[model samples]
Target chain A: MANSNTQADFRTRLQDWIPKLVLSPSLAAMLVFVYGFIAFTVYLSFTGSKMLPKYDWIGFENYARLWGLSHWWTAITNLGIFAFLYITICTIIGLGLAIFLDQKIRGEGMLRPIYLYPMALSFIVTGTAWKWIMDPGIGIENTMHLWGWESFEFGWIKDRDMAIYTVVIAAVWQTSGFVMAMFLAGLRGIDNEILKAAQIDGASNWNLYRRIVIPLLRPAFLSAFVILSHLAVKSYDLIIALTGGGPGRATELPATFMYSYTFTRNSMGIGAASAVIMLMTIAAIMTPYLYAELKEKA
Target chain B: MSVATQDTAVSTGRVTRTFIYLLLILFALFYLMPLFVMVANSLKPLPEITGGNMMALPQDWTIEPWLQAWSSAQIGVEPTGLKPYFLNSVLMVVPAVAISTVLGALNGYVLTKWRFRGDSILFGLMLFSCFIPFQIVLIPMAMILGKLGLAGSIPGLVLVHVVYGVGFTTLYYRNYYAAFPTELVRAAMIDGAGFFRIFWRIMLPVSGPITVVSVIWQFTNIWNDFLFGASFGGQSQPMTVALNNLVQSSTGVKEYNVHFAGAILAALPTLLVYIVAGRYFVRGLMAGSVKG
Candidate 1:
């Protein structure tokens, strides 16, 4: 009897430890790869590291130099324009599509997939398609000329002044469908009785949506805003594939700026600083949201 | 059902309904036009694209561009085409997705069924990793890969993807298993089923939906990833990088048709996944956002 009890106790103890053991590998990986690597990058930013990561403390010198560079300013300015336009346009189109599709439309099944297939595509693929279509020599401009519109001119891909807008167009095309899906999900989850009640109260369609439905979609709006803003900030693949950072530095955002500095330009310190800034920007937006989410669950 | 029928609040007139359908169709066309252009141009010969209407169906359809993109097109000094890179991506994505999913299932199982102190904090940590701009880890990750002698290789890419992907996969499984009844897990445990046994038999058998969600999400993201493939991919560049090289190489006469074919080739796998399992794809997207 004593032997069996100890054996049972040992099995229970081992079983208890098994869960922790199983979780440790992933937790350790997150710590080392995610948190540890983040620390290393932050440390690299404070040092005089360039060309390679050197261990000499320099105390924000890279940041000061980073701030002074005209190229950096251009990247920041481009990012502001890109993020603002990208978010606003995607939201408007996405919400519009969602509202329309929610109205018991025919062929909704076929249309939703069409709207979302772009989200499945790599930004590179999207970029290549858009780049070709936007190319003046062989793309839309040429096609327009061929079809008897001799005065057509759509050279935004090659034009320095308007290249960024082309990026916005491709991005919107790729993601608006996804935003629509989120809103649709939100719309579906809404309590229908409330809508009926509001209808019985004689609210017009416009007033019903504006006063009841739209307000109820607050979570969806927050999710879209957060997701879109982060995507805009981390926008890299599309920029590289579509504009290659420009018709001459016209579309250089912070992501491209970080890569060029770190890998190509041998300014690892500056790149690290820029990367830290990017992390902080995302964290500022993400931390409180995460805290709220996790705390609510708790 | 009746409430759902009346949920639209105000029924619209025929004109408004027609207008709504028209607007939806227009937006759908807008969404699909680029894809249509790509498909159409990819089938046409070079001159048709350069000198003819892009919106027009190909007058002389040919698969030459597709063949060239798959096998003979020049990619960064190599005439090896996207075949090898596509293979590399497959190898990278498969292992990365598999390992991360398994790890995530275990982690999710533990976090939900086998509760522990500070588990929520740990989960919060894992979840936050999903949203970090990966730029911060690029330099250090490169250094780590170099140290491990895995730099620029397929394995290196796999390792990086799995490490980053665990957070997302974990989130999926956790949210899923949270809704699962603990009674089954408890009954299995009382019957002397070991950890792996219970998980394999009880948790995993019922984990199909979330698994689909996790796999589709991981496959798409890993296949479509460009920044890592470029930074760490060195010699074994993935399809996205290779496609970019094929399209962006400025030395040769630009073959727009070939470029479109290559882009389509790069897009096919994820596109296939989306078409086959788009419901789960949307579920993954929604789950990733608006966290449970």
Candidate 2:
């Protein structure tokens, strides 16, 4: 009876702690590694820490220094440029592809997969391929030269002024497919009768799509736009793989800058401050868009 | 079926059809062109890859690069290859996807069908968690993992993936469950089926489409990931990390062929998943549960 009771007590203890064991293991891992580090970094940002997490509580000094840093300002500016240009160009390309494919043409399925395959591939691959393709000495320009056209100058990638545009091109390739998928979903979900009625009214293809289709695809457009912008804001991998904020921080975005500061430079305070600012900027930028989108859906 | 209607349909639609086909073909070529260059170049020798036009087919076809990429050049060692890292990727991604999807489905079941207090709040928290950048939480998460002595282990990486994955998986499952009729759940409950029983007997069986979505999404992310694998996995890297070390940060003699082969190797799993699950992927998204 005593042994049975002891065994029962052990089982009860195991049962009682199982949830904690299971849930806390993962949660605690994330809370410490992810959330805990974030909090630690934020706290470190407020202190006079450098090289590592040392604390002296030098309130707002890190933020002020970060703001004063020209590279920091440049990174912020570059992020804005990237976010705007990338979002616009990708949206246009994606919408165009989606609309073109929505016509129920032959090979629609094949075309859809072709468009989306890049999204499946890593940004590293995309960046490598683009880098090689955009190389002035070896790629398209050289090909043109071998073909006896020596005047071709596709040197945007090497040029500091045009390097960001190359990144944009790669970005468009990687993301437009996702947007296309969203648009296609919206297109298929629309009522066929509306198109039939429009056709009966003698609407041309351009007019029908422009006036009827595009308007009805507002929900999809909104969703695609928000998602793309979010991605654009978080885009560090592509930038790193392609340029590494190359040609003297000319292509620097906030994420890479924060990474360099936090890890490479060992400037924990500034890094944390930059991270906080990035979070705030993203929140400020996205909250209104999300609200508008959700309101439309509601 | 009428002659006149057929003629009109043919005439009007033919122009549009031709235009659409032309555009699609062009876009398809544009999309395939770079991938084609990568693979075609990989087939060529290093000299040929560098010397010839990127568009050119390999004059001297060789499988040496593929062999090399599979063996020495893949992992840090110059002999063994990427077999271990590939196994690591599989080990982490499988459990990550399985756990996240199962938990997500459970959360969705409870939130959508069950009349529970604080359900909306829980759901909202899950949704909002998606927007929090990993950079914000990466440090703390890493520190915590280190504290727990799990910072450098595969199980630790799997746990991290599950935590991050929960938000996305929940969204996926919630979107799916919301589109489903509530009457089914109500009927099941009125029949005196307990929560776990209903989820197992009814919900799980019906969750085919969304399950595919969750599985594919989680698997792809976990597989293609570089940041999590690089940071959390440490010396024991996933395929992407090893691939990144090989291809991204290269040394003096750039073997373009090997790099291309490595890229192909790295992309194989996600590409295969996308191709296989492409139809259902679109179907799940078009199920129109996640409007935003």
TM-score of each: 0.97, 0.89
Give the per-residue Cα lDDT of candidate 2 at A205: 73
lDDT tens digits, residue span B238-260, model 2: 88777667765455677778878
List, residue by residue over B71-183, the lDDT tens digit for candidate 1. 99999999988999999999999999999999988999999999999899999999999999999999999999999999989999999999999999998899888878899
Across A189-252, the per-residue lDDT of candidate 1 in tens digits comes to 7888888888889899999899999999998898898899899989999999999999899999
How do the candidates score on chain B by TM-score? 0.95, 0.90
Per-candidate Cα lDDT values, in order, are 0.91, 0.76
Off by over 4 Å in 1: B6-9, B283-292
The global Cα lDDT (0 to 1) of model 2 is 0.76
Cα-based lDDT at residue A153, candidate 2: 89
On TM-score, the candidate that comes out on top is 1
True contacts kept of each: 0.82, 0.40
Can you tell me the CAPRI class of model 2?
A: acceptable
Over the stretch A128-216, how does candidate 2's per-residue lDDT look in tens digits?
A: 78877888866788888888898988998878888888888898888887888888777766777677778888888778889998999
